[model samples]
Target: MFLLSLPFSLASAAELKFTNADESRAEFERSVKPFLTKHCVGCHGAKEPEGELDLTTLDPDMKSSTSGARWATLVEKLTKGEMPPEEKPRPDAAGLAATIDWAHAESKRANRNFTRRAAYENGNITPHSVLFDPKNIPPFDGESRVRRVSPEIYETFLKDAAKRPGTNQPFSPLGGTTFKDMGDPTIDEPVTATLFRNALIIVEGQTVHTVENGKIVKWNGARELQPLFDPQVAPTDAQLEAAITFQFKQILKRPPTDRELEKFVALLKRNMAEAGQVVGSRYALATVLMLTEAVFRMEVGSGQPDEKGRVRLAPREIAFAIGYALTDKGPDSQLLAAAATGGLGTDEGVTQQVRRLLDDAKTDKPRILRFFREYFGYDKASYVFKEANSGGGTIDFPGHDPGSLIADTDRLIEYILEQDRDVLRELLTTNKTFVAYRTAADWQKKLVEARKKFDAEKKANPEKYKNREFNPPVKMVCEAYGLSDFPEQQPVELPKDQRAGILTQPSWLVANSTTFDNHAIHRGKWIRERLLGNVVPDVPITVDAQLPNTPEKTLRERMAVTEQAYCWKCHQLMNDLAYPFEQFDHFGRYRAMDSVVDIEATAKLEGPRRNQTKRVMQDVPLNRSGLVAHVGDASLEGPVDGAVELMHKLAASERVEQVFVRHAFRYWLGRNESPGDAASLQAAHKAYQESGGSMKELLSALLTSESFLYRVPASPEPNAVPKAASKKANS
Candidate 1:
């Protein structure tokens, strides 16, 4: 009879709405209590509350206890379609609608109550508003956001501390009861998905343990720690001292001594002073805790910008900065610690030391190439030029033949660093590649045979070959042909045609192009995005359907007929940049005929905002040479000469220098460039220009910046303290 009466009361209330807030609450408790007690109490009851949620007690009837808080939370979860989860029996459509309707009302009332209470406690709502505004969210300020390590940092940290490589088995940092209550029902936090993919971390052979109250109990044991996690074992006293010393040295950029060693030893002893189980285990646990997601990323300040308008890099970022600036071998904790402590100074002595260290010819190529890859979007070391007969991926060419170059690693480093040309300029426009002698020689022989056939054919038909330019013989063939006949291919001679810059270089040309035939749109997009700081929207794969098998068709032709009602918004810019590079085919080899088609290779490539296209040299009127010639004619400056000047201007620009510095700063510091950082960036930019854009100079400037040295970001207005005059007078 009571259950039947409850339905009558709810139906009556639904027909007539209550105007008072108290009436609404009364109506809710009366109508909803029966259903909640019967259906929800089993799992979300006061005792064995599932998901730490109890929907029965809520709002005015529920006080400040944790379980009472869970009611409001349960209301939200049910409304979001996230609870009564897939495993549970789903509510019928009518029931679901009623639950959702109640949840929204309850959430609104709860927020209103909170706001009133907060307003009463505080003089103003401004403070609360500052922290909880839904819109205009600030960038993540390295607080709770640094909840987990990135894969790269995790690997390095584990290897350094555990003397173990990261397992490929799946692993999660969360464990035990903490894992179960991961998503607090009373709050809006979501449970995270498990980590580990691609069989990256195997757990089959390991006996994972849970550390609770300083005891290392095996998993499924008596006591439950917060969550399942594999903590690092404690380092031996000597090892701890060694690691700390190494870190200090790296951060300070110098070695630590006896006094500094004593401090680290003292820290170890302090870990053992607390009351706990195994002393060593406790100490080990302390170290692990320090290295956990919470402490490992030590973001300081209230996440608000500090007085100097700068947010200091945390320990992890400091480590990254150190690793990026000093080595390509990857991050080392010891190196980071040293860099943090003024050990790595930018004084002349340290500079000389670094120069000598990097001078080793063996490691130099890899290091420089890594820097090139990071900054300029190219890395020769990892590049593959051809596919092997066995076939997995393409093959790479080492700088030297296997047995030909000197074996010393230092010698290799020296070779990469000792070149006299401007390093930046070389990155942009050098055709004199450092190819293996064997590969160079093999191509030479092939070219010689090709030239003989060409000459014979030309003699037979004078009209066809009389004025046409012949393909240059290969280097080895030219060596045999003597320098006079094929000067461009001869060994140890300046290239006659240094027309290609970084964009047109064989490696870059092949790297950016999707098809063997260059797509003007792709080329234009690349230039705009990578070179000119414009964002290009991605085209759909379906767009590729428009292409036909006509090998001789130009990129413009492909785009025009590729799609029905195809838009040319991006194509115009792309074609402009691409037509000039038509001289080079898909493989980045020069071509007269595209596949079997006669090259309609001639193009008049015009400069940006310019009147006409430049004509380059061309056998066929459509070739790249005619375009270059047309471009060249506009300036009367000639092609190679004009390119050289442009390269110099670009390398010397303040803007270009800053872009490099900003990029390095972003990578090393683990933070984006903030407006506050503009001054420091400019300082580094200035230093780079003054040092003739030496990469080393830029590093020195960055390390010296206040952003690098401080543990917290500086505030916007320095020396502008509130009540400053009063304080000064009182003092």
Candidate 2:
């Protein structure tokens, strides 16, 4: 065990100058022991030590035992006024301060000795501190490095390379907590092997031959690569160079340098000489350029450094950065032209490009939508499974599909983004939403009439309508779902009071809930972490967090078990925040009471099915009273009656808007926020406030900020040579 001796040694040296150990021991016995006996010994003494602390057994000599760390904890608790349980006698202010000071002094001495001893044993010492200051953060040096392309971006790049609308081939999906792909790429064995396999498949074509039951079952036509490889006639040297340049531009978003071009040209020539034309060219394209770092990694910045030890991003890099920030695709022709002419080098030029991109209807604004999906975590709705043969079918909707719910949420988000109003506030409080069915119109009325007539005729004479089919009015749903004609349906507007913003949306409600019942804890935890930026500590390992399956009690009543001191310590921070969402059922349908039901023994046998079981459901009055705190805004932190009221308060919060700005910073920069990026974050926030919370304005400000425009060199060795200088020296 690590031991501390510095404090006692220092005390001894000081005592030799003025006093003696006998006087110090007498003072400790008179003051410290009496204080502990009066205020701490009851719960933390010999008979039954609380928190495993036995203050009575501790040695009076601070450095003789391994008790300095325990002393530090004691000091922290006393200083924070968390010791001396509420019913117990409290320490006087002077006494508390003096004790805390002594403990601190002892802790420092012990820490100093511990550091020296650790360095001697481990060859290094690490600093430990409880305080953090933003001013201590280092500035961005504007260095740039290569990062791998994300899965989505790689697909887009492949489409551009193949000169097709899309290949429709699947790539491996990235995994993370957020729906957004922020995973760092690794050149692991599995990754490289997968890349090689994909490269070969793309170059050759997709083909399928299936045999089943000892028979030749099916064969599909192999995918043709003629469109991608066709040059119309035998290729000339200039034609090959032109093709190489085009491919380079398409994949890398820039032309190859002369050196790179020469190397590739030599490789192409050698391949052509050995294998003739088509086969060699295909092999070269697949194995050489397609597999290079230039195709897979986004390498930004020219090595030229300014006086401030920062480097400006290459003009092309600026264009690609701005383009990728707004959309999944690389820079368009106009952006590339601007970069080529050095027009993208200034703030004004970048602002112009940003505005143009945001205004472009063709630009994939879905990328922005995707950020919100990941930020809110509503996308998890797609994977939620409801049991078909379970008790309490009270919350069931006949046609409620998780995919449709997610799509509806996306539509609502897209609508709000298109309007470009107070984006954060609107998302929190807007009542309007799109449903799976469109609003009823003249065609809808006619379709309804036709459906009614058909139903009547079918009821009267089933045989007459057995072979007949009915068409509905909507067009897009039919097309979207791959139906030959519209289905029978009419859309209904949601009740305004029953719903509000994203919080009440079925996507969020269902995603955060269990199969048969609501998960108030999950809902509250999401709001606390994602919106308010407050972290909830993990439950203790000793605690079993499950609720008892009591048929008589409602979920709220059962959850009241957490009100006990041991459980309430952590649950208090979450349960109150989640209580308000009790207004909505597991399926997000508004309800006045909690559905209570007895689970049949056979319910467990039912697996991964939906809308099959029926059970007697009793209504229990739902207690929707909830408390909201730690939002970092006074106006928004208070008791709320339900989800609607909570949303109203959140909509008015400045902190909510700031949280959104931070999320945007993470989304565009592909990293978390740092103190060095504060200026950019502030500018984005300012733009949102000044422009009435226009998302486009925030994007423009962020894209033009110093953090986005420049980078520091990856290596800072004084004698390190620049890439251009190194190339010249090699030549």
Candidate 3:
């Protein structure tokens, strides 16, 4: 009778249109309490609760209660019949339906209140506005600020400064995280601090010494500012001004305006009055000009917007942009000449410069190598920690170091670019690889020669060779005699069929692995996000994501837990994509078994060993079946058996080609693409397809696009009242 009366009371409350907090609380007390007492209180009551839920203490007001989410979860469990455990008493059909309806209504109210509070706190309905949406994006607002020189460009600039005609200071490279300089706009305090610290070091003559041949050698390089200040040749006032002008041109990449020249000259004169002329000039160049934004940042033109809401970049700005896009240094003589003649302001002029820069051997190799290094991220191999004692240590085979692996990858990229035929496809499917150590016989011969030379030197001069650095020769001996140490740098050719493309390289494999094991998820995520242009959502906060560590079972077998219904929702997208890499171990060596006996065990027993842990080989079947989905192109989406097969499919994919072009756009533009950038992207893609996938042609198209050449100013807000209208209304 009581249960039947509850629905009637709820109906009456509903008819009364109860909306306020007090009224809603009253309704919940009358209709919801009876249901919870009868069906849920046994397991979820005050004394002892199930799943950390206590229903009796829960507040009737869902919006104000912290337990509102728990109520919603309970409702879901009841709806799905996952609760009550099949043996416990279950609510009848009508009773269950009533409870579910009330829970859902309260949940919606709570969510609405939460969202409203968040919006109020943030001062907007959305915290962050999307910068780019394919359907709608505003025109480019030539609103770029003077950005600081990137780490790479700054290092090159410093090296060049040290090599100037009168300077004798050895350049000390600055080190810090360079993400901000590399187009990440987020302000980093560390990078800023590092720049300031390095500037001071360059200004003051600090003694920098190096240890050579067991003796400390002091380099007086920092004190020798002979190029900037020569005591033997005292300059007149006019000569000093000329010298300052030359420096401004070199450091800022442009001759200073009259006002800037006047300010700097005054600074130099004040310093000279206090100290000597040499000290004054050094202080002005190092501490003053070098720290200014003119030297640190690449500044474009700034002026009032024209009728079309557009502005053109200054000629000098265009020259700097073109030069930095192709090389780490400032503009060359030809580029500076073009800027002076105003020839860099047109599409045809820009194309000619781009062609010349691309063809120049000085610019081509390093730019292309750096581009691939950033794109593939295989350079991270130098930093990734790998365990030497584990089976994965096989990557240290005969004649390979992390550095050589990186260089080999760079060489392969250079080779492909030279071919200029379907470059992306070749990168994905090419099987040939360059290596420092190739055939067993050649490796042995080099090792023998190095060992013989070391033995002869040590025997011939016992006293002189004492405390000599013998590691290099010892490492060579190890490689020659089939010992443990990896060989040093020397190029050789690997068998063509042993590898296929960048994916199969040791550098990439080591980079994406943990110290003792492979992370298939990370590898798969990279391919999905980078190559396929698909996004994989982060793991849910509520989930404790971890795979079981079962030594007896293979990695694939242990990963079967992801096949469960709840976990499969997200894991299905990543696990299958990464499965193909199982053929290679964590250290990137191909193996039929999951673990292999340590081949360097004999070398360890012979003398002091690097890794002393015992190793055991284990046989396990590797599953290489993988699926590529959401490619839009149907032909490239399906199951694959191995890394080679996966690469073949990727090579044939149109989506892959588009993604490569998109990455190139981002790399050169130093920012993500916007809706306004669609025309530029399309032009580059068209160029790639038309020119038989030539990267040079694609770059030319991007540089000549309207998106790169012009910029529009931001529009005024709609709510803003015009000054003329306001005055007329007042009159």
Candidate 4:
């Protein structure tokens, strides 16, 4: 659509298409020489050849030389959109195109004789080739990087250690804690210590129907698997020695050092001789402590058992890893002790262990329940009202007269396993729990009374409860169920939005709050950091500043506008996210309408704003906007078809999958998966999808993947700077 123009003097151009030298010279002068003279000669030609590049004095004969390559390099600069100097006299589009074509033609002719280079000559893989070229990779090959004798290896090691006829024994929980802290091992601590972390496992079962014809035929077996970790369970005097030796071998992926082996023997002998019992619980506890170390941490191995890089963990260790990762409490001592005695080796014991792990009144009921909540981003299950089933379980609410008690653990598990509904709906909407009313009525009554009393105390003194609400109450249930409590409160709800989800829960409001301030900066930051995983560093402490207290004003206005500047520096991000939860009252109960005068609904969370506003003035609480309405499975009526469909949609999304994978990676790998790990992660992610997102399958894939078992750190690359700019400046 556009006409062309060119000037003579093609000889000066660096690159040009030509049938011969004469043709190239003509093309260069006619199409490229004039343009360069007008736009580039002033800086690089006669007066000053910046970076030693002079377009006006360009030599047509030096076609194969590096100096002749400068013009071709300039064309690349223009292609990348980083040139034109912004203030310089730039060539028009057509002129630039002509230059580009000429440069490419000359480059091709000049590079014609260059031969392709072969791979490494000595067979020693170069870093560049090994990383950049997949085919050149030889160092890894699974056997080299993938260490054998994971927890699976531990089983053999334990057997060996136990048979070694040593004197060291396992630690006991009854006598006292025997496990030393992983971060600090100066003092022996209980396995139930506060440093425990829980692992999350989501299960989805697909019903496979085998139909030969139209009529129903038979049901295929149900494939069930879970993300499991093996814990070191060695209790006997000899077992302790074997466990340490085995741990060293597994961690190092080779034989243990003689010195290390001797140390293990010495430690075991001392423990057994001092404790006066080789088969005591102490020996088992000590072994568990060793397994908790970083060396024992394994990635979700390859999705399949036969994967080349798969990291294998022993069965008991798998159980321990699952328990430790999923809950604040470490491995269940009872389960470990049972395992140490080899009771879990039989079919019945294995089944019992699975059931026991899931049925342990201490961990399964409360700790596992909390683990689910932690994964779901909620502190507790939502309330729900459902008629008790035919399951025989007495229900009870202690502290409250005539409270029903739930006797069976199965009934309790069923009541909480409704994965379709958000926990908020289950906790606030449900009033019924499968309880053996007659069996646990008295205990149930006491608990109900305590809750009622707690609720009454909160209502009587709004100020007292205001800062006390948020996730604390749900956490209390966890503690009562024997799980270690995090004891930190987080604002989970907005004041305007009732339903006591976060704002009113006892754990969230009081743990980090002041008696007077409902939403203190400290509490707000804690909620953002802990609940949302936002890493908001702490602000420097200063003298307490008096904040305005008005019924009409939101927390932000009262703090930022009235408070000093030192506060806003850090409060900016906190206010953006926290203010949204103000819709919830202190008791976590949502109110459709509040009778209080000068009703206020202004709060914001901590994050950068699009408008770059200094204050959170325009944002409205979630309740007022109807964005956060009551949601429940029953409310949708009938079966949760829509919710299931939505979940499928989320699971299918790359973003959602990434979130799950990231969370799972952090759990299994003990650190954030680096971008360099993307290859292995990509492979594992593919396996996960292929395995239908089965929690166990995904974990298997990750554990077996190269990134999980290998410990090689990624190398950094040097920053690249275009050579054209350097040459131009020098001229």
Candidate 5:
């Protein structure tokens, strides 16, 4: 889809200072001004700018002005390649690309990225009423979208798409943690490099190279390639068909259409002619590995349109959606069977298949647990670096490392989901916790099994395994917590008074904390947005966000700077919401008092000259109070004593439950919630409430809703980027 229209105000643009010294402004005037004046300013000029946007007077300094957001939106509009009204002269391709790059760079300076902006708005910034109202749904047409698979999902995709299972080097496009949870599937050349490299890697791994004489043909090569690489003989039409047919079964799960087969045959023949038989087979395989459908989850419906101008997704499409939503792998045999029999074309059929996947205890549907991991943000625990002596001086809390805490949280989520009752509420208020815990029996059994394998291998060749120790890997617990040496009790019942829900868990606290202190703002921000369905605007461009680093003052007292008139407008939404978390230290240990360093209290002259000074530690009573303001629901608003109490109050709020539903819709749908999605959102929320908060009931209702099942395509236009093929595996 294209933005088509963007509304910006130039009211403040004229007030900014601009001169020859301002290189950015100078470039804008010289290079960008004419492009805008010709293609944009005619309709968006001072006389009567369309959508209240005056491009002629638009500010160039996007880094420190309100124009940043508008500029970012403009970049999105241009990059979408659908601007210029679709009737006016198209932009100069070379100039257009330069302008987009410049605008995107400026947008980054102000920390506004529009690629993921739509999903963010739908999940967080949209008005709660607009997304949840029963009477506010759009017509029964689906917005076709493509969601990018994550690196993990891509690994699974490779295994399912081709016979290849693993790669030598891990494939990461951005090379860091820059990706948002569910980002837009963008069309960019940068991805071409990542995709092609990985595709080549897949093809190379599958090819078994045996450089013998051409006369020697052995079973050493893979059976799939034997026919294609027959000694000294070119592949025949029948051989090509057989080769494609085998790949279809191994990878695509269904026979390729005649057109698809023809294309593959042509590609194979071309590659064999250009390169030798063995080399050409690898090239042909690489082409198959690069198919966009194998890399991205495509949701464009294939069936014909109905009387209501809606298109129902084909059985295969529905199965793929259900499978991708629930698991990283492709549609299982059962799902494929359902699609083959046309069982996925109806609402009941989709619901039944989804429930079947949910019911299978043996199937590790990590996506279900994956949602809670992202939803709670406990998955980030391992990444939040903390010095050994950051807050609490001692490292007594060594057992509950970030990874273990996240695993414990995952197990906790799975436990709650296993019960499938009051899931959201249970996640917020449960006192059950796992501390350096896993099933000891299971651990011992694994240890014995691994030891046996190692001993057998080492015995087979003692000199070959000279110095290697029998150190087996563990999961969901600390590697050094000594599961083999000292087993921990499972699912220990933490004190209800100290720990209630996941909010009070050590993992959550540590993930949201700073390296040197507790991050009340981050903690508060999570609750305000994730729980209350409210948004806190980004910190202003003009504000210097650093707090006073006075060790004598409490964290709260030092944070008093945010209460200043200039800052409180946004901080008021987060600071108090986070204040309740102060009862827990930066290490997440519950405390009635804060551990602080008071230089005067610990002052001592200890040198021989009696001039050297030392400062010892002291404690101050903690202020663990928080306010629940502007929650929309009057009953849910008030002052709370601690994080647990605040969480309990939030858990009881209907708005909280509805917000949870809205987020789930965004996560599973791989897009933002629209006015059209209100019906689905409302139904899912209602299902959760009516079925005693069963996630099964909620997902069933959501998966079967019109938003997931029907597609209402927009009217065809020139230069519209097809959503399905463009999407990659980013999520």
Candidate 6:
């Protein structure tokens, strides 16, 4: 988004003149090859090549060599400033731009229509420092693409149309680090076949069932096919049109276009000619379910491109995007009316609608909740497998109940979101967490008390008790190490020492845990990438990633393998940040003894635990001290006692808040920020800070930013500018 001043590289790049092959190869030697030797050969060459890419021998001639394909794969890596990764040396801006500009020119001349990898394809490709750099806010990276309606949304479409639920969910949502809403599934042969089969099942499942003579019958609602059920009467154009219109509204949420109307009608007649009325009508409805419009909600802008090649999304597209961004359903009637009446055209207009939907309590804004869940990654707790039935293995005490602390974490997040004040900080440092009512251990005690009171009341007043069924006021809360079921709208407060924010929550701890121990490396990596907004380079292929899982050694001792100079380069970013969490075990039980696994709650309840606590839970010294570093702020970087202290420090940092805002951009905008998107990110950060950390204001500002409202379709000379550095002399 930096305003593209006329390129200084034009005089330099014009020297290459890829008009033919010979001149280009000569220029590659003069400029490209020599420049890379001086700037890039350090990591990408012979000594220790990363990503299996040996750039020293790569051919620069895109016109003829086999290396053209390899260059295709690497274009984004080079242009996005991901080359010479943060830890390594990099070219000055002019040197970097010259190399990238050379790549673009060659690719254009080669006429290679390689698939463009947008920001959503890989969020970590852009530098975090570059993204949040306050002084260099660019115009904006307006996204331009259409995402297929996710499998979940397609299932809802089925439910709305046929009055039946979907079963064959072909689109599996991605998990771990990636945003739920951002996906681009290729629709090739097999995918097309799956959609066809899925659609047929939905249409056929709606038929009414009945026996000719005897017992009761099942009713199937083939309501769309009802008129065609009577084959004795020949079908008319009117009936076909009515069916198509109905299916259009039920599935696509809009009336069919004249072209679409004719296309479907012709389809019905052709099928009817071959296979009778019932099959034809049924196939026709199923076909409607598979329309491209039905499958993918287009976010591609509506109007012609502006002078800068940006396009604002049309009102209807805006409505659809906003609806799915905040909720599971399509735009409501009010939202649709606004789109129809041009209420989504301007910034104020779009802001008005977004604010209305966000404010409406009845609207199930699950996307808001989903953002936090995915952001913190606590939802992965269930996926971390541990055996409960095998008694020899550690009993998942606090984790015994299915999703026990997961629900607790959810409630805590909801509580903070409801208050909506400094939400990110509250989620990180809040001491008040939801545990089972009163005490999880006292459920039976409370039940006894409730029964005693109930019996006394019944004894005193027999007439009143005659018709009443006894239900205990004190009941078990089936999460937070819960054993029984209790119905309560809100949970009781847990003490400060017992919990602190999402990071310290038992579910998150359990989720991040490896099979045998707490995944401190992964945990620190998560904080490094997610909270600190930095990328940890992929583990080089040569490094053996597995720790020597020695139960006899402490987790740190086992991790001794990572301290080698090569390994430590990346490990330094994670280990110090992660060790603080060692005070809590994989199950998130406080580890008083270093060597002994903490006793689970269920182990105490079911067995002779007093003896087992002494036998199984033996002793060793504990180390909870850890350091926070590389986060840019010296004030925020230091030694800390444990996760609580760590989380508090992170929660208070402006850098961390900006990281949170960047993630919210990913969730709301559905892509990582491009260089142009710095403007949007900065504006949103300013709004959050100025609004006293209101998520609503932050979201409003982001949703209305230039990046949200408009899109750049392709790279242009006018925009897509790189930060410039002076041309460097080659070695």
Which residue runs does candidate 2 get wrong by more than 4 Å? Answer: 1-138, 141-145, 160-174, 177-179, 200-240, 273-277, 288-299, 303-308, 392-395, 437-496, 537-545, 561-570, 598-614, 631-633, 716-731
lDDT of 6 by residue, 11-62 (tens): 4533434676666666567667776887777766976564435688777766
Query: TM-score of the candidate numbered 2?
Result: 0.67
Clashing residue pairs found in predicted model 6: 94-725, 140-676, 141-676, 141-677, 207-220, 208-220
Best by TM-score: 5
Model 3 gets an lDDT of: 0.60
Candidate 6's C-alpha runs over 4 A off are 1-33, 36-74, 77-118, 164-166, 174-177, 205-225, 388-399, 437-498, 596-617, 715-731
Ranked candidates, highest TM-score first: 5, 6, 2, 3, 1, 4
Each model's backbone clash number:
71, 7, 2, 145, 7, 6
Model 3 — which ten-residue stretch has the worst lDDT? 119-128
Q: Per-residue lDDT of 1-731 in model 5, one digit per residue for the tens? A: 34222122122222223332265566566767888877888877898665445776667765444455456546645654445766788887656755654554444445554454444443454457756756645445355666556566776766643435444223344321112336456545666666776676666655555546875444554466567876667678988887877766655678878998999999898888899787787778767656766666677777677887878777888888888788888689999999999788678888889899988878767787777877888778788887654323354344346766777778888788888999999999998876545444555576689889999999999999999887653432332222333334556666677787888888898899877688888888788878887756566656898889887888899999999876786688899999988988776777888867777644553554233223345788889898999666788889999888988898898999998897788777766565556777888898899999999898888788888888776555454333432232012
- For model 5, the local distance difference test gives 0.69
TM-score of each: 0.45, 0.67, 0.65, 0.35, 0.76, 0.74
TM-score for candidate 1: 0.45
lDDT of 4 at 153: 27
Q: Rate the local accuracy (lDDT) of all candidates.
A: 0.40, 0.63, 0.60, 0.38, 0.69, 0.70
**Native-to-model Cα distance after best TM-score fit, residue 390 in candidate 2, in Å:** 3.3
Across 569-611, the per-residue lDDT of candidate 3 in tens digits comes to 5566678778888878766776655753434443354322335
Question: Against the correct fold, how does model 6 do in TM-score?
Answer: 0.74
lDDT (0-100) at residue 279 of candidate 5? 77
Tens digits of lDDT, candidate 1, 39-80: 566776778554334455444322111222234345434433
Q: List CA RMSD, all candidates.
A: 20.9, 14.4, 16.1, 23.5, 10.1, 10.9
Question: Taking the tens digit of each residue's C-alpha lDDT, what string does model 2 give over 1-731?
Answer: 11121111122211221133354456557667788888999878998576456898865444334344456456545643456755677677556645554454443443322221221121101101110123332355332545556667767656644432324434443433223444254455666665555554554432233446644355442323222233334556676676566656545667779987787767766776688655565566556434455334453577677776677788888887887777767788899999999788888898899899988887775578878887888888878788764664443454346776687788888888888999888888887766664332544676678789888988999998899876454443232222334444322235566667888888898899888788888888778766665535445434688998775677788898888877664576688888888888777777777778645532553543334445555676789999986443567778989888888877787766776776676677765454456666667888899999898899888888877887766543443434443343223
